[model samples]
Target chain A: MPVANMLIERRTFAKERGTDLIQSDEESPALTQEFMVANRMGIHARVAAQIVKVASRFNAEVCIAKSDVAANAKSILDVMSLFCPYGSKVFVSARGPDATEALSALAALFQTKFGEP
Target chain B: MINDRSSLTIRGIGAAPGIAIGKAFLLERGQIPVPRYRLFGEQSVAEECKRFEAAVKEAEADLETIKKSIRSEFSDHARLLEVQQMILRDPSIYDESLRYIREERTNAQLAVIKALRKAKELFSGLSNDEYAKSRIADVDAVGDRVVRILAGQSRSDLDHLREGAVIIAHDLSPADAIQLQAGRTLGIVTEIGGSFSHTSIVARSLGIPAVTGAEHAARLIAENDFIIVDGRTGVIIINPGETELEFYANRQDEIQTYLKQISRHSHLPAQTSDGHRVGAEANIEAIEEIVAAKDNGAEGIGLYRTEFFFMNRVELPDEESLYRDYHDLAELMAPSPVTIRTLDLGADKLTSWCPTLEEPNPALGLRSIRLCLHYKEIFKTQLRAMLRASAVAGNIRLMLPLISGMGEIFEARKIFREIQAELTKKRIPFDKNMPFGAMIELPSAVAMADLIAQEVDFFSIGTNDLIQYSIGIDRSNEHVAYLYEPLHPGVLRFIKQTVDAAHDAGIPVAVCGEMAGEPLYVPILLGLKINSFSMNPVALPRVKNLIRRSSMKECCRFVEKVLRMRTASEIEEAVSKMVMKKFPEEFHVFDPNWIGNTPLAAKKKSGS
Candidate 1:
């Protein structure tokens, strides 16, 4: 039931971010998954640093995309530029041997809201 | 120099009322100038980048040192400092500075400024939200640190403050405010903030004289300059002559002596002449206050404001922390009933979690029980903890604040039942028969009092918010503060109605606001038949003394007459005349001046 509601919310919000997406020019696309920013403060600087910290742990080259802006998940500044406000959605894509692990780790961060209220 | 210097007074809002004559410790944070100088050569440009990098690292180390040294109670401040450190290292500012240095050929200081400006552009581009603006401010704060470091300056540490230092600062964050040592920080004067700000709350809690909103305090008051802070009236007299010092010193002595004299008899039971009695309890947040409360003859904790456990942090306190706090408080109070009010954080206190709920008018916004119900998970976690803690001390009683109507009471009762069932199934022992109550601080609650009284175990009146909301004026507003009269006709009528409703339903009522404490208002409350008085510990003795001296017959007569009166001034005049006429010696000794709020105003902000 919760998932169904989230699905509708995702669609309603994506209608806005959909206008900003640009297709990647790579020959084959990286594995991608979408996550919602749940914390009240959204993907702020400190949360961005947590993503960079997690992303840098693996060999995967990860990027977080929101509103037409794709940021290198290893760069705090780059991740902060994406600016995922609370309740917004972001797509995480990665390419490497540990791409699956990288996506899951970022997923967990978003799930816990980087351990914030 | 002392002889030549004339006394100059700087006026600001009095956050805490007291008198402090001490030397100044100017905590001029983030006030350094950014010096712009051109790099002479490639060698100098490279050196400037290294300089900026080293300063950034040093600032990081400095913040880490402070964070490590910070006690666990200030975990919120530590988290905030950690974010600042991350901002210091972010490529948006760090790498951007290096990029600007190499590309724009600007000096490192100028490069740092440009980098920060670039970061600001990126943040503002995301959205013109308050969150983005705060992020920009964080960047600016980090930029200031690097600039100050580059210019060969050091950060002022509040932890190492000298004794008798009255801290004069731009402002202290809530965490910094909590870090102030009572003996070390004789007083606090900030350039910004009102009585409700964290600095004021902490200053009042620590019993330090504090004055905020002094615009020229930092610029005018020099380090080690002798200053007298009259926290009662928000006056700071700098370079005072002998006569001025003598007068302030005498006033200080008189206040101390009067308080000491009254507190000597504070432990006496609050039983009126005609054998009428009411519980004299104390309102407190920290567990450290159990001793003070006990010393002042507080029968039990009247209002254990649980918001302190949740405030000043990026994360909500887990069930474990909340449980431990409630359990410890329950154990300390033992057989005495401790009423724990659920989260009553208005927008101002819930800053960390309610970034999105920044209502234009927060007082009328979703708060207290409303905020709890909206954040169900948060509320549930607290309820679970409170129930678990109740298992340990059986004396814990649950109370809801700002309960506007019957719907909220029913809603909270439902939550309580769910938690109880969960506890029962889990075999977690708790006080199943624990008393539940509602705080009667709103007119709607008063109107629905008889219904609410039947539903709850008791009623506690928060007269601070009751007066504010009842009068349709913010007491914090200087223009309307005078109208914050507990004796106001409508407020008095509301109190009378609530007490009547509770008695009709065979339940007790406690008044736990400023009105519950003041001697001037004791007769009025006792006359209204309030079952208990819970207020600041210092106010307990005098309030109890007045209650002990007066009879229910006289009080009832006064109330009957005051009820017929039309204006607050008339009611106030009659009460003052009767109380003063009866207890002239006690009145003369304490001199509470009977009019202004005095030191009693320094208690923590209203929990509405």
Candidate 2:
């Protein structure tokens, strides 16, 4: 398999999560990943924006690396084309001032279910 | 007898009014021809290619501007634009155009049209994948638009047109309806389709009459043939012969007179002159319908469908989304009883997130409460939402659809109890006394109603499905549609039995189906001692009008008389005559509450 290391950012769930949270990953960073271009749906615009927001707060140049292609994490369009099937994982690599802390926060979000991850 | 000019009189259930005396616009299926391309010229092919690229860039700019316009008009139209953009930017469309340029040596416009036609070929065969098949419809639509634009036609997108004209299309797409100017368009009549098509929603919304599945409407009716549309009856008469013209003209006059008279009784109580009252409620699909139902004087929302929440969505709705929808519905119909059936999905309504089960016979296979029973987690999630919503509105009941026997009932009850127990543990101040009921549709359930009623709080007979299943006829099947009679002796007996069973158990029985909305069956249902009737809100006023004109005894008498009939036709004829005799002035009255008069004190004072 042509796999490349890409940073996986966590998206949180809104308040009421009963069953929706069940299918999500119980742990973060080591989550199993599937690939399909976000198709037309892209991750919900709000969810993608929130993920970008979290990455920006860490002042790190975030990038999503697929097997052959790498894209800027800040661009919703580029990340969406990566089409991470619902329960797929991508490695997170941030090389900036707040890289380690940003990676940890992203990991915790995935652990919590994207808050519902 | 043919007129000098070739003329054909088409009979359809009419949907809109007025006629235009214009040349007929014949919209043919995939008749737009592909143009030739001339890329290899005496000078240079590269220059021609550069010009084509510039034209494409220009088209792309136009597509973006249209996308923005569509977005401003509709909040969710971006979804459509996204699809359209993908098609416009698809390499296949452009590659085919380039191939035509290289092979046929065609001009830019011709090459683009040729390419789009080639792309149209991709959708020619049906795909086994449902999503793929649906996308085929989109491809055809976008292909037509692209072809039209390349042909130098103005971007007069049908969806954006707000004029009140009858739409003439080969067939309408769901996306087309979404794009339509809600306040404009009179109605749409296609030469194709049956019930549940997208055009039906458009016609219903514009409140104009529509006739679909009309094989060749485009060829037959010359533009604007002084059309008289009666959407309720699904009858369309164009350039009627002498008798026909007179009949419709008189019918129109009579309808206007009836409207005037019904206005007088609009504010009247839904009680007969002799004082037996009937509660006519509304069956709503969305929270928006709640307001329309209330405005139509619905006593309550008898059937609030929950399936819509799950439709057209990618993921399962979390408890919050469910709670918000249910709570909003409850809040809208607050104090009035709102009966919400848990996700009544069958194999036909497959969700990607849920397990897919293939069944040879889906109608008889696992669905409704049965599916919920096997999939407790799905059912439990919905029940939890309902319980939480029940706190917002005091009188919300959880209904189970397609329950056949005691087994399904007990299973649902067990799940209900489990949810209640969980709620109690959480101290969620929910109404434990709220009624729990089963829709008496399956013949097995009707046969065992008395036994089933012993455990349930209420019975809501889903007559549409009940009649179909009981008669062993699929009403959806056009060939057997005539056989799907609601008043068949077998169907009547089943309804009577179920109603009597519920009444004897001191529980109320209501009907929520197309049958409840029909004026012809109102008395028959009343005679069966049904306490409530629920239908589309538009039908509520007319049903109420029928109730006001009828006493329970009189309805019982009519029912008794009709029961003796041997055939469906005989029953229908007898009921029609009776309705004409008893309600001549208001036969199929539209908008009984349109006049907005409160029921007279004398009428309300009379006792049941």
Assess every candidate by TM-score: 0.66, 0.68
Worst 10 residues of 2 chain B by lDDT: B593-602
Docking class of 2: incorrect
lDDT of each: 0.79, 0.63
lDDT of 1 by residue, B162-223 (tens): 46688998888654675577787888999999876778766765678899998889888998
Per-model DockQ: 0.21, 0.07
Clashing pairs in 1: none
* Candidate 1 per-residue lDDT over residues A30-117, each given as its tens digit: 6778888877667766677788889889887787766555666776656766667667788777777788898899899989978974
Highest lDDT: which candidate? 1
Please tell me which predicted candidate would have the highest TM-score against the true structure. Answer: 2
Q: Retained native contacts per candidate, as fractions?
A: 0.39, 0.00
Residue B437 C-alpha lDDT in model 2: 90
